[model samples]
Target: MVTRKLAAVAAALLTGTLSLTACSTGSSGGGSSDPGDSQLNKVLKAGELRVAVLPDFPPWAVQKADGSFEGYEIDIAHELADSLGVKLKLVSTDGDSRLPMLQSNRVDVNVSAWTSTNERAQTAGFTIPYDAHGAGVLFKKGADITSYQDLAGKSVSVARGSTNDTILTNDFPSAKPVRFDAISDVISAVKTGKVDAALESSYTVAQAAKSDPELEAISNPPLDPQLVSMGVLPGDQVWINYLNNFIRNLIASGEDNKLHEKWLGEPLASIVSVQGNAA
Candidate 1:
């Protein structure tokens, strides 16, 4: 009888212990002491911040000839890691992979010039705008295109899964979109005359025009001016808040402006508003 009683006691204690463990770990499965602090706590404990960036987007994020990354996004990742006192690991991703990486916990944040949209916000959290630019149309010089209306029945190229692609797909039904996996491919399509024009970030379009004499950006008002921000997997408010505060600090200290001038050779206001008031 005593043996059976002791066995029952042991089973009860084990069950109790497991319950406590599960509660302590919460749903994150990271064993976070505070359930709400999953990603933030994980990053702090791991001593590394994994960030997703687009490697082929020049003047933003690019993998150089030496297999190292440098650009505005890389610099911003460095700043984020420095503030967190953790090492930075840049995860090379294309536009289609950025949010997926975050959702899978493969990356803690996305610093890949992600534009904020209401549809995306349903699945991910976004910080205040650290950068902004409208979509610009890049076409061969002397092309008759002057506005979106001029592109009716014309083919436009854009990076797959990018905001530019979404804009082209939804807002410009009159134009056909040819999507590519990389920004380079999108531009190549236009340069090779495979497409009528390439719709891309205004900043990138301007850079492309500068390097190629035959390329020029349409003078029409930019399309779908987007506020670019850092993105994180939703449901982790703590991590989202931390990134939001980090961006606010950058703006308040004028570091964002410095980064703009350094890489883009222009002031912040030239591309986007300096309004950092959003929470």
Candidate 2:
């Protein structure tokens, strides 16, 4: 029965776009909501909700060997499917490949940990953020670098197509930015001394530094961090609004922090300021 329901939802979502009004009734997330109330309804009706995920990003979204997904994003995606009243179908990909899944319509939506930026915004519409943290360069302990400008004419390695890449590419056009296939590889680049410094999300860098004592973090550059958002194909206000309210409700209900701990293993309080509209 659930399988049939997912099939139905897929048909409708694939048929065309859905208006926000058609999916959301401005109704509050009053309970353990079903995916039926918001833009998720379109997916539920289609009988299957195609969700893109990246397993390499721990504490955010990770794929398990048993075929189940682990991490905060996966937990929330499950909640999203529940709210939409459909089955949650997982589509796996890395950070660099997630956008392609969304663009090709191979997946209906991307719940993989996605950082929003002006460049990505042009390709995909974003919901409000679930997590926000700054990107910093990780160097060997006792390094002399103070800011992004200090890295001038030096080799900088970053995850391909990540927000850090967009920022460094646009901000420090003179710096040499090398693209690694994954965030982990970029992190490895720093430890391997393949690059002068490696740029990565603080969440990942902090985790890496905790386990390895040699990597030192440079706090100054791009003091502004990136906010992670749910990615959707453009023109789905119904889905967009649904996701926005879901995120807002996540913060309001305290589930946001709970999920953070569930996957990240600690409360990431430093990024709270980036959770909503900035001051």
Candidate 3:
């Protein structure tokens, strides 16, 4: 059933025929308490929802050869636009551009695999978590790594400005860190032997390893697990609240689980849970 739903969604996206509601309506969790005072109103009145999304994060957001995007994050963005009864405009972003794009008003919201952090919270508003994942070490089969401690002296590739980059920087200072602007570049660094390993999302690591028999991802006891949410401009309490309610409705309708399974091929419970950043 989930596969069928995903197929339909994908088809709709490819054909630019997503079915949307007649108007934006908040969920039972408290429908936009300040709709007129935030980006929510602006988006609804404009009849379009501009969203920032990663163009290269596979399983989250991937740009196809045809220049169309389809992934878990893409689905979420589509759903949000659908609920608001608006046209969805996807603006491409990278790891470092999400917050900046929101701040510049180039996009209304960010759904680009954004992990919630206290530091980020100070600069942007995040809706309640809609997804979660943990970090893992991706290496070739014969690499010396077996545990986090093994990474101490090894060279690891990480996407610049990503949480994985922070982990390598703060937790394993002795390890050499190779920073790339895109997750694909980080993974390619590992595959091409430019780096000994890549620190990335466990799900992404798994997907990469699955596509390459020579690669392996060490995800047991996943590291630095994080909760993921949509990012909005700071102080947009009304927009933030509306997205939170939308996520609640997504969960209640079981659509979140269906989407998760379709993209990640596992139930949400199988993913590690974390308390988020200590700082």
Highest lDDT among the candidates is held by which one?
Answer: 3
Please, what are the lDDT tens digits per residue for candidate 1 over residues 1-279?
001232232233333331322222123312233433557767767889999998888789889889899998899888888777779899998888876687677998999988888987766677777888788899999888887778778899999888898888888898989999989899999899999999998888888999999998987778888788888766555555556657766765677888888888876763343455342
Sliding window of 10 residues with minimal summed lDDT for model 2? 24-33
Better of 2 and 3 by TM-score: 3
List the candidate 1 regions with Cα displacement exceeding 4 Å: 1-37, 269-279
* TM-score of model 2 (CA atoms): 0.74
TM-score list, all predictions: 0.83, 0.74, 0.84
Pairs with steric clashes in candidate 1? none
* Candidate 1 residue-wise lDDT at 148: 73
Preferred candidate (lDDT higher): 1 or 2: 1
lDDT per residue as tens, model 2, 1-279? 112343344334444443334332221211112234333555655767788887766657666778787877888877767655668898888777776676666787788778777777766767777876677777778666767677788788988877788767887787899898877688788888888888776666666777889987765543456777888765555567666655666665566777788767766464652453242
Tens-digit lDDT string for candidate 3 (54-103)? 88788989989998999988998888888776799999999898877876
Please list the residue runs of candidate 2 whose C-alpha ends up more than 4 Å from where it truly belongs after superposition: 1-42, 64-68, 219-222, 261-279
Q: What order do candidates take by lDDT, descending?
A: 3, 1, 2
Candidate 1, residue 76: the lDDT equals 84
